[model samples]
Target: MKNEINIIIITPELSKEGGGGIAIYTQILAKELSLDFEVERVVTLKERAVVNRVRVLFLSIVKVFYLLNRKKRKIAHIHTAHDSSFFRKSIFVRLCKIFKTPVILHLHSPSFALSFKKKSEKQQENIRKVFKLADKVIVLSKREKEWYLDNIEKRPPLVVYNGMNDLISSSDKVSERRNTVLFLGQLGHRKGTYDLIKAFKKVLENYSDAKLTLAGDGEVDECQKLVKSLQMDNSVEFLGWIGLEKKRELLNSSKIFVLPSHQEAFPLTILEAMSTRLPIISTFVGGIPEAIENNISGLLINAGDIEALSRNILKLLNNTLLCDKIGEFARERYLTHFKLTQTTENIKKIYTELL
Candidate 1:
């Protein structure tokens, strides 16, 4: 037990500054994997200043090579998304292969299929070279697995839902929640922040006491201008890039959580909302429907439909019984299916089998 085999998790960065979703997932997954294996995490990218970026990459390369040289049973569990992440990790994947270490390429990129379709033939050849070197490939959702099955010339990618520590708490249930809808993701058209803002502006018409708290940062100035232009400056508050403690506070106070993304493989924020027992109202895109059941765990609306988004928000805000019921079901589902315990167990099996 003390001398368990090592597993190296390669990612852009282990910290939050690298970006959300994958950064958060890699950190949480690495922490969980550490308990079962001698996990050593390496970052191929960093949130460094422009001048120091190349220096940082060089140091990381040196460190990774040193770690890979260690004489121990090891598996390179590379958590790769599409685009430059795959490019950056090519050397790591090659090194692990040269070392004869089992490689697990975990795909988190949402638009992998779309991206691959657009790639030039030569570019496609290079990408396929990386895929051929992997002992096994893992993806975040069934849709992603199917995407790889159609593209990659290998056995189907295994589906492994990204997991996190239980967000349930003793004082979890808020005795008196506010009439606020929370949107936690990057502020952009891709995440449907504009649609959320439009729907939220309408939400204020019926429930004037309602507040729409938009957390996370990206094009804040534009979103703020949109809110101001719509005369929703007073109702909408953009709390840019909050910490875990602050996130919990916001989740606790809010009645409903939404993520109207145009694209996503699986959203960690929804899982967090589910864990916090918030009635979710998100767009049915990518793997969201798999995590949320329409009128069951939470309500699901079509993407870009502000009318439906607004209707769903008002539906939950007005109906306390339904909100409580859906929130309860969401939390139960997280405990049963999306918890770290279940995900880590599956990861352990993949590691054990891949060897």
Candidate 2:
């Protein structure tokens, strides 16, 4: 085995300050990879930091050229979207082929073919061509990996579930709890913020003492309006955006954790909640089933089923025994599979094997 492996991870959009799942995943994974490899991150701030198109294009070109000429024997691992066409085939992909080094495209989203097919046939064909260029593809969920293997021939992907760092200790577990529900993540339709609000309305019917706390920000006006229109001001609380300390505080104090997202590859918040011994009630989408067992570790309801969502929320709140069991089971699951130590070891092995 080589003494060290040099790897470069390039992403179009990377924010060190924003509250995005991809950013957090990249941060943690990068830190872990650094323990065993010489990992350098090259990020392009597309619209957030750059205003001039020429400057943005020039910066991307410089970054690529720097990676291409930096060393001869290092791997250029790129984080790219599936449909990032000519840019991928001619720029990043072509560079790897030129250097005679393997390229790993770690994908976070679903196939562009599937998403583009909903838009137009021509768009789908364009996306299909882009998929044919990747040397090795990485997906976060089994569903996503299977989708690629089933649709695309000769370019199968490796499935690796996103991992979260363990932030809680044995002493962090609390015996006392209040009647509070925590929802962390974007306040948008696909995240199921609206669905959670609707379910919270029904949940409040029986559990009048319960309060709902909403964290993270997106489409703020719409979510705020929905809460006001439902006359749930007294029961609902919104904290626009919070840091690590406040997030942990909310998770620790809350009685139940809920995430009703319609689409997700994997959620870092779910693992965070489980790490703190919080019972999760989430929608059955993406790799959620891999984390939560229906009615075992937690409850999993349909994406848009408000009635079932409300029912489960109420069930967990009313029955303290069920809540304790689920929360305990969730924490155990986190310790058993999602802990960062094992995740880092597995990832380190993959890097060494590639080297």
Best by TM-score: 1
Candidate 1 deviant stretches above 4 angstroms: 14-18, 48-51, 170-175
| Model 1 CA lDDT for position 350 | 92
Please provide, for model 2 over 45-145, each residue's C-alpha lDDT reduced to its tens digit, 9 standing for 90 to 100. 34444454347656766877776677545676666554442244336666666677667777765334456457566755555555566566777777777
Could you list the CA RMSD of all candidates, in the order they appear? Answer: 1.7, 2.8
**What TM-score, computed on C-alpha atoms, does each candidate reach?**
0.95, 0.89
Model 2 TM-score, 2 decimals: 0.89
Backbone clashes in model 1, listed as residue pairs: none
Off by over 4 Å in 2: 1-3, 12-16, 46-57, 81-90, 110-113, 119-126, 169-175
Q: How accurate is candidate 2 locally (lDDT)?
A: 0.75
Computed on alpha carbons, the lDDT of every model, listed in order, comes to 0.84, 0.75
